[model samples]
Target chain A: MGKSIESILKKYDNCSRDSLISLLQEIQENEGFLSEEAIVKTGKKLKIPTSKIYGVATFYNQFRFEPTGKYHVMVCRGTACHVLGSLTVLQELEKVLKIKAGQTTRDGLFSIEVVACMGACGLAPVININGSFYANVTAESIKEIIESYRKKEE
Target chain B: MSIQIEVNGKKLEAFEGETILTALKRNGIRVPTLCHMNDFIPSGACRLCVVEIVGNPRLVSSCSFPVSDGMKILTNSPRVIESRKTIIELLLSNHPDDCLYCIRNNNCELQSLAKEYHVIERRIHGNKNSFKLDHSSTSIVRDPEKCILCGRCVRVCEETIGVSAIEYINRGSKTLIGTTMQKGLNTSSCVNCGQCIMVCPTGALTEKNQTHMVQDALQQKDKTLVVQYAPSISVSIAEEFGMAPGTDINGLLNAALRKMGFKYVFDTTFGADLTIMEEASELIQRITEGKTLPMFTSCCPAWVKYIEEFAPDFIDNLSTCKSPQQMTGAVIKSYFAEQSNLKPEDIISVSIMPCTAKKFEMQRETMGRNGVKDVDIAITTRELIELIHLHGIDMKTIQPEITDSPMGVRSSAGKIFGATGGVMEAALRTAYKKITGEELVDFKINAVRGFEGRKEAKIKINDDLEVGVAVISGLGNVRALLDEIRNGKNDVHFIEVMTCPGGCVAGGGQRIGVDRSFIEARTKSLYDIDDRETIKVSHKNPEIIELYDNYFGHPLSHKSHELLHTCYMERDVLL
Candidate 1:
């Protein structure tokens, strides 16, 4: 284990209902995803019902219940990206990866997620493979993008 | 202080901090709302209660809007009605169109509202939710496709029961009132108290339909079907038959069950007397040995489950006696089986209770650990009504008959087990006799009998031994009392807990949409039955006395312990 949840939780001594959002955010940052164990630990420390903590956590798009794959692909659905048919791009990526939105490939190589307002709206029809952005992407170029990653890994 | 407000062109006196809906209803004006439930904080998620306020340009929800001095409000103006109609139409566009086959059917609030607004044509045919029904819970079912995102069930589960087993998983339109990780309710820490089903305005939540199983059982020729109904059913079942709320119909029910092909239609009250016999002895043993100081009554399955889930430390403190329903089942299988010349497996024991948790309770491994199942099936008061109607048995014209011998006769103390604090009252009546070798001068213990959340009494068991006792109804009220004892701030000797607010009288499986007055009426009928009875205490019941002399030998004997008492397990709350 990288670090026990107890060690991470000790950084912030404020275990109140008011600290729920921030506590969840910090735990997610440390663990890369909000695990069930983390959620339960946070619930106990904050003295809040886990259901209520879930209510607060699920309201925001920032939280992820599952960890990301080794190679993450984020499809931008910003206003400009939507105007440029980024939804088709997401569908093409999902079809090729054999996974839906917010899912990782079974082999643990690739994952796909849809994000709103990805900040690079100028680069419409965007699919950021890992940290590298592939902008103005077409459905024809989708296989080439994954093949490039697979070849690099080899 | 009263604030004057104009509602529907009429002047109304609004209490200072009351909502606009309250003020309007006080003035005989009605506004439709689905998410709002009495005794819970108003959830303004449903836009049906939107009303036109003169100063504000937008339509505001009357349920959460506070009444101010000289506020002009119109509940059913053209614009407001149009807004409400649009909201219902939008909700209809997404809701499943299976109202005919829906469990709620004509009783559905959404259906009634749609009829009121004439939402015949779809304005917005949006993508409908296709959430699979959660049939994992033994007592309750969750159908997210029919859910209107009201959050009443979520609130009641969290606020009243103190078990937040379900919650909002996703946000906005994609939101689902479900367990964490979208797991089945069985995996979650749901105690199977069907209060969620009671508050749900739609058919999205309901009891797991055991009616079909019951019908099949009735049709089966091989099994000897032994049926028993809880004490509360006498006062409760009449309401389902379109009779008055508090009419005691035990005699009629006994006759009807027999006519419906039940071989033995027994009263569960006899088991309640057996519970008192064992529970009182256990309390005396614990008091003498000073092991588990304050014994929590285990008569309410939901309360027992609550302790098992949240407060596992106090599991030993809980009285090991099975609930009267399960106790009756055990006796039927073990004791009654040998007497009736039938094997335990041949007898199909069915319990009719005013609790949804009883369904889950019967299925516990502990209940069936003694080789024979205590109860084969447990159905709510609602299911009993369904069976009665299904058989077309006219309850009114039916000739009243007495219950069978041996497992039939019960004292009034046992009869009162339906209401809150009834178990404590019955136990106190017997415990007093056990402590001091004399029958109580006054049989009635009024201190532990009521609709209040918590009640306390100090019994004088002679000058040297004064015992403190408390009775709690709701699980929310239990935390404070338990905390007191845990912190060593309270010296209470015995505690009584009935999970649903007013015990099994207002149990999760009782009739939905019950008012406070109806609960009081049912509770009064129980007390009246106790007063009218020749024998008021559990120990004094002749059948129970004969049972001890014949079968178990004495109270808390090895056989009584094997048949009556049970153990609790610590459950994972987060799972």
Candidate 2:
């Protein structure tokens, strides 16, 4: 509702085929993820086929095809976080939300995303949900954190 | 200017800026390649074309390596052969071992390569891929597990057809070709031209098998099964029987259909003649009224769908006449049913076409009347061959038989609809006579006849009406013309667009592994018939005249409009 895909596309010059990635990025930034409609709309704007746009988007791991839930959970899978048992925490988070990494919950209240590093090695097994960090998180501790978000959404 | 290059110790002249593969090909040397499509930029993804260069320490892919002056290369060096063998072995490592059950078992390029390279054992075993087959499209099927990821289908879809309905989805080993959003092809921008199936090196792409439904229909005692083969099938089907390419077996086909229990065997050329009558009249009406100046021929279903999806603005410019296949189906359901005193539901109308798009076309919601489809099933030329083989009919021993009366007689102009630029030539023949009120001095308009993608000509219908015409084959050649029309370029009066390059003679559903000479031969067979036939124009066809006398009063009559023409609407796709 913030801006129609057509309105967002009107900002870009149509001639440049090189702007496809940046245009998709901008749309994903606005809409939280690249919707099928957004990809098709962007393809029409750039005179490129949607299959090609999706191909380019899928080549990069950064792009997501699904929208983020209201509470976006980021589980750091950095070198420090991995050594500190963040994998267990991530597994627990996925179990609690009943969704895999990079997937939103069925109710759209919670989503889980795997990140490389949060640049906070001291916080080792870091779990951030909606910008609120739960540092030194354990597998048991992640469940309570997810419960708190679901309760807060209610 | 030419450059000298040494191959296998023999010096040869090569064109400047030509690839090593091109030079070698000119010198009658063959190097194996997987991803090298003709007239397309080589991707060099498959290293099977690797050759040993004298100066370079590493083997280079001959398909991408540019030929230079005094370049020496050994195409079949022991090391080069070993490298190619290893590449094939590695490809087969993860490939499914169900070649016996595959549709393209004997004709498969990968299997042929494996045999050629002596890949006798599972040299490098890897986890087999288990991707699901995509059977969403009515015309085409996608089996990703059998795909070698050659990218020929992707390139042909994007480059040749101008509809990038499929593309590379992911990166590296995980990369696979898929439609937008990994959804099925039905939701994608595929026009169902089946050009992808033509370029696919393996059994990954094939026409949807409708032969089973045909077999089922043949068994029904109460149903009257009528089969119509397109104009191109007569010339193209001979190749499937090990006969010479472009061998006209139209009479033999009628005999075979009858042998297979088909009650009536009608020629689609008669429908082509009917299309010309209606389409020529529509063009004349549009020209006289000065509306829809350049009437686009809607004979190609893939081209019609492409306009409906990608270029909807030109929908108004498209002639309202249905293609010969549908026109034949409609007439068979209505007029033929009435004549035979058979109910429309009791008649099962099947079509044998040199196209995959006809399968999708017959299923269109608008192609039927009161929920009874005009055409019950559409099969490709390949499927017809299968049916012939399945019935164990001896083609060589079969005697020639004549087609049924009334709807089977066709002019040579109608027969030429199989070739590119044929619709334009046929339409111009009738349009000239309609506009000038005189038979054309020479029925053949050579200007529009060719294998070229685009052909343009200006003809003097009369002093005041010198109409411009353009004949285009592939959809790739249409963008510039469409842009011209959008920019108010009004020189052209009629445009004929066939989705497949070189028209239905080289259609997507024709025999695979065929070369350009076969297409040329098939095209020449049609022209050869036209050269000797007395009835050169569609209007001169006795059956078409009799049809107007009996059923519809004339071309563009209300009854004709109801059955012989249809409307197009804008279609939204994932693109």
Find the candidate with the highest lDDT and give its number: 2
What fraction of the true interface contacts does model 1 reproduce?
A: 0.57
True contacts kept of each: 0.57, 0.95
Q: Summarize candidate 1's per-residue lDDT along B1-575 as a digit string, tens digits.
A: 88899887878788989998888877878899988877667879987899999989999999999999999998889999999999898888898889899978888989999999888877798897778899988899999999988889888888888888899888767888888667778877788888899889999999987988888898889999999999898998677777888889999999999998999988999999999989998999999997877888898888888888788999999998888888899889977888989989998889998888899999999896447789999999888888898999999799999888778999999999999889888998899898898989998888888778889989888888878999888887888888888889556989998888888888888888778889988999899998888989999989998888989999888887888888999988672
TM-score of each: 0.97, 0.95
Off by over 4 Å in 2: A1-7, A77-100, A121-127, A132-154
Candidate 1, DockQ score (0 to 1)? 0.63
The alpha-carbon deviation from the true structure for residue B161 of candidate 1, after best TM-score superposition, in angstroms, is 1.0
Q: Write the per-residue lDDT of candidate 1 for residues A37-152, one digit (tens) a residue.
A: 88888878877777767777877877777788888898888899999989888889889989977777888888787788779878888878778998898887878988888998
For all candidates, what are the clash counts? 0, 0
lDDT of 2 by residue, B1-575 (tens): 79899999999999888899999997899999999988988899888899999989999998998999999999999999999999998888888889999989899999999999888988698878677789999899999888889899998888888999999997877778899998999999999999899888899999998899999999998889999999999999887788999999999999999999999999999999999999999999998987877899999999999999988988999999999999999999999999989999999999999999999899988897988887999999988999999999999999999999778899999999999989999998998998888999988889999988899999998879898999998988998899998998989999999989999998989888888899999999999999989999999999899889999999999999999999999998886
Winner by DockQ: 2
* Candidate lDDT (C-alpha), each: 0.86, 0.91
